[model samples]
Target: MQITGVWLPIITPFKDNKLDYQSYKRLIDHYTEKGISGFIPLGTTGECPVLSDYEFEEMIEKTMEYNKNRLPVYIGVGGNCTSQVIKKIKIAEYYEIKGILSVCPYYNRPNQEGIYQHFKSIAEETPLNIIMYNIPYRTGVNMENETIYRLSEINNIAGLKDCSGNIKQTAELLMNPPKDFSILTGEDLLFFLTLTMGGQGGILSSAHLKTEQFVEVYNKIKENDLEAALKLWKPLYDFIPLLFKEPNPAPVKYCLEKLSLIDSDEVRLPLTEISDQLKDKINSIILK
Candidate 1:
């Protein structure tokens, strides 16, 4: 499937230290109507690391069930251990998902060759499309454009969630991307810039808030209506940063709860609720 348009790296909701399936299902129903391209659950924005194995499986099952094939779903399956990552992919494969968003191995900080092999191993093992997520700030290792180009040759390797945080590197890849290999930005602020530079779309966390407006921005750009796209984009440009002003999903959950889209704004420990100060700021923005 073509990995294009505004895919939500969807936030997992919690209440009383448990998965809130009610809210989760509600979010799926909500976004499906809002013109999002797809759903990406269990991503960093979904608090993947902190989730228990049962929670992980339940989230995938619920996502598939709740989504009901309304849009494409890509589960986040990645880790330092290749075997474990592959195992997660096996679990996700049971669902009718479009693909997996696998991040470059973290903490161990593997070299370029190792990074290529890591993904190559994954592509070889699964029939599912792989969207390699390269976020140097989080992973501590950037999957350089050279390494990415090498991986792009593999048929099912599919696409990238480009969050390298380097414009030069992003520009180089967009300039001459491989045929049928998508380059979607993971960086929310760069959505407009990336699309302008030939990117397919974005796996945006900030999109959870604006929904239709974000889709309109992508549609506007694709229609070559730059003026209209910018008009929609400028306000989003300002609003996106606040969601990340605190640790992810926290601020996002807060907004969702305030809007009554979800029942509560609870996130797991090590990612507590957003601070009252930050909440004030976000309330002002969203309430406006």
Candidate 2:
């Protein structure tokens, strides 16, 4: 629907290398109390790639059960295979997800036209609203503004998770965005800057720790208090890098565990747990 405000690309917590649905539900309860606007289960923070199909479905099922439509839930449905991605989207539709955050295909490095065709097909295939996720670093192919604008023309292709990391591009898009197109930043570190550039909000992992403070930043900016928003975002200058020091959800999951929101800070393979040194650094700051 209208996807705006701070959404958590929540980590899929693991215990003994198994999906901890109990802990997962508990984490949602915690963030719900924190007043998070929505949840993005199975996103990068959710360790989507490593999860098996069964785990993926079970996770979404659990998330939906707990969420109970309390807040919007955007399922992460992305893959290099257009058919497979659409398959995943259809599966999510079974749960009646509020929306889908489909990433630009990774590894294949599709040409701009290929990117357009891929998302265009998805929009055609589903009645569900889609938020195109453009993280060129991960996908290896940038969805240029023109391509994104073209996709935006499709009625069901709702908005974007702009992780292009190019200020000029983000600013230009914001300057004259499509009607009802929500431009939410996927970059945690750029949340403040993105808002200043007229972004809707962010799908942030750093938000796992200081949830209310992040919300406060958005509220301050919406109230047109840049000074107050900047004050709230200042501390994140140091904290954001640390959350990403190791790799995504690893650092974030570690923080959540420290706060007793999750059972463990464990992550799946290809992504190790956070380093001891970085853990100490995080503990030193948060524990203080």
Candidate 3:
């Protein structure tokens, strides 16, 4: 499948401090109606780390049920432990999740070679298409472009989620990538910027609000209407910094909640809910 266009790394909603399945399903329907390209569940915005294995499986199941496979579904399948990720990859294969968003192993801080071997081993275990997620700031190490190129040699290694926020890295990878290897940006703030450098598209958290606007920006640029596209995106530019004011999903969840798309303003532990102060700021900007 060509993994292109505007995708939302959706926030897993919580109600009464539990996985809010109904509310989350409502969101899936909501964004689909709003014209998002695809949905990415259990991603960073989904708070994958905080979710239990059962919750992870349930979230994927619910998301699939809601989307009805109208769009490609790529479930996040990365963790610090390779074996565990492989186990879930097997489960996803059985469950038939469309693709895998295997993030760079977090907290372990593996070296370039280790990261290469780590993904290589996991790819050997599953037959599904794999998209490498490289968020150096969060994973504590950047998956170098060269290492990424090397990994791309492995069959079924589909694409990448480049979140390093370094345009140079993106440019380099785009300059020399394996045949048909897609590159989707993780930074919503850099969505349009990344595309200018020849990125395929983005799996953005911010697309939760500005779905059509972002898509319009992408379409304009794709159709060679740079000026009109930039003008359309100008109003949404400030949203990037504002959405990330605290942490991911927190600010995004707050926005979805404010729009009454989800039932709860709640989040799991370790990632506290956005403060009223930030909420006011988000509201003010949202109003303006």
Q: Each prediction's TM-score against the native? A: 0.98, 0.97, 0.96
Candidate structures ordered by lDDT, highest first: 1, 2, 3
On lDDT, the stronger of 2 and 3 is: 2
Q: What TM-score does model 2 achieve against the real structure?
A: 0.97
CA deviation > 4 Å runs, candidate 2 = none
Give the per-residue lDDT digits (tens) of candidate 2, residues 1-288.
557889999889899999988889898888887777899999888889999999989999999999877888889999999999988888888986878999999998999999999999999999888999999888888999999999999998988999997878988998988877899999888889888888889999888888999999999999999998998889977788888878888888878888888889888889988888988998898656
Tell how far residue 23 is off in model 2, in angstroms: 0.9
Model 2 lDDT-worst window of ten: 279-288
Candidate 3: regions farther than 4 A off: none
What C-alpha lDDT values do all the predictions have? 0.93, 0.89, 0.84
As for lDDT, the candidate ahead, 1 or 3, is 1
In angstroms, the error of model 2 at 213 is 0.6
Query: Could you tell me the lDDT of residue 263 within candidate 1?
Result: 93
Ranking by TM-score: 1, 2, 3
Clashes of each: 0, 0, 0
lDDT of 3: 0.84
Clashing pairs in 3: none
